[model samples]
Target: MPTAAGHRAITTASMLTAEGGLELRPRLSEIPAHVGVIMDGNGRWAASRGLPRIEGHRRGLEALRETVRAAIDFGLDYLTVYSFSMENWNRPIEEVTDLMGLLKRFIRNDLKDLHKAGVKVRVIGARDNLKPDIRALLVEAEDMTRANTGLTLIVAFNYGSRQEIAAAARALAEDVLAGRVKASDIDETLLAQRLDTAGLPDPDLIIRTSGEQRLSNFLMWQAAYSEFVFLPMHWPDFDRRAFASALHVFSERERRFGGVTARGQADKVKS
Candidate 1:
């Protein structure tokens, strides 16, 4: 990442406004290294509009496509999305099938384009019960885009935070039982290494759409200090403006990571 003062002037193709007018934008500073999104409100959006739920999901895909491009243009290094979860299986079978179809379509249609744009796709989740074809598609996407060096998109499918932690603990327990590692040697870093997102940096910001304020069991361990931005718009309605607004707010915040700033310490003393 370059210094905050170093914004290269590029073509205005990606800086178009909602009205399609070109605009010169300042270079972004204080960009978060990793961002996580909880995509919500597809079903509610469809219900309110008296449309099939699938329509909202389809539109959400478009939003995701635009967001990926925006993240690239905005200089974000890593983006993680809560695509699907283990709890999602409890929904209607028809909806689950539709969701799975959408997932398949997204990979088949978008993988080539993403690879061309230098994006690497990584799926983090349990693969035990997925259909063989779904598993194959995921593996294909990862293998195909593994060598790219641009933005890393992490898709959390069939994932649950508690389950993720338990799996890591289980793996560590097995190692200890086998005498490969001692129980006393375990620590935060060692536990993190046993998780699926071992090599990836923790999220700097987490945004949830549809006005949700809770984490909904996503990235429990990885989001310890991540700043959160909850939006009233549905997932399908999230656009570049929304993304930029979140980043702007993030830039103004002072992240002390459980400590106080010099100003804060001075105020404390004065008080």
Candidate 2:
């Protein structure tokens, strides 16, 4: 775990910044390395079409497939999606069951293609409460794609950011009690290392569909400085074009973190 000085902010080549009124711009290749998405509005999409909610979810899967391919084509290294949340269990039992069935079917039907495409599967969520068969399927997906070197697909199934953070805290506390670590030594980097997304870089950009404007507990900590794009279309309508547009928006913005950029400095001087 590195201190703030040592924790270098992840940077892509050719990024634009405001410096002394000079336009500092990034190159076309300076795309985000990691992207997170809140796959929303599936039920709404289906309802509008006079179809079952499950149909929308099924269509959403198709959109997800396209997004995966698009991400790879765009040269992104990682993509995390909110597949399911712990709160989703509050839905009717039938809806929950349908979602679980969809999850099982998707993995069984798509795992081979994902492996063939060299995608690495990573599941980030609670597993103990899941049905045995579903848990087994998730494990199988991860094992089959473990060795692949291409895009890493993180599925946040049965996940909740607050729960994840609490779990990390508990783990750290246990470590302290066992004399494996000192409470005084805990820091952002150390705590992050204990998160489900330990090895992965924080998302540079997060996109939510159906015009939503909220985190919904998805990657709450990891998105501290992430740029967000809210799309009007539902998850099922997301496509390569929409993805490209989001990237374009990301490219046009400046990521200043906590400091004033050169442009800001210039503006202050002029004022």
lDDT by residue (210-252, candidate 1, tens digit) is 9989998899999998889999999999888788777766665
Worst 10 residues of 1 by lDDT: 1-10
Q: TM-score: which candidate is best?
A: 1
Each candidate: RMSD: 4.1, 6.9
Which residue pairs clash within candidate 1?
none
Q: Estimated TM-score per prediction?
A: 0.91, 0.88
Q: State the lDDT at 190 in candidate 2.
A: 83
After the best TM-score superposition of candidate 1, give how far the Cα of residue 31 lies from its true spot, in angstroms. 0.6
User: Residue by residue across 194-247, what tens digits does model 2's lDDT show?
Assistant: 899999989988999999899999999999988899999999999876887787
Candidate 2 runs further than 4 Å off: 1-28, 266-271
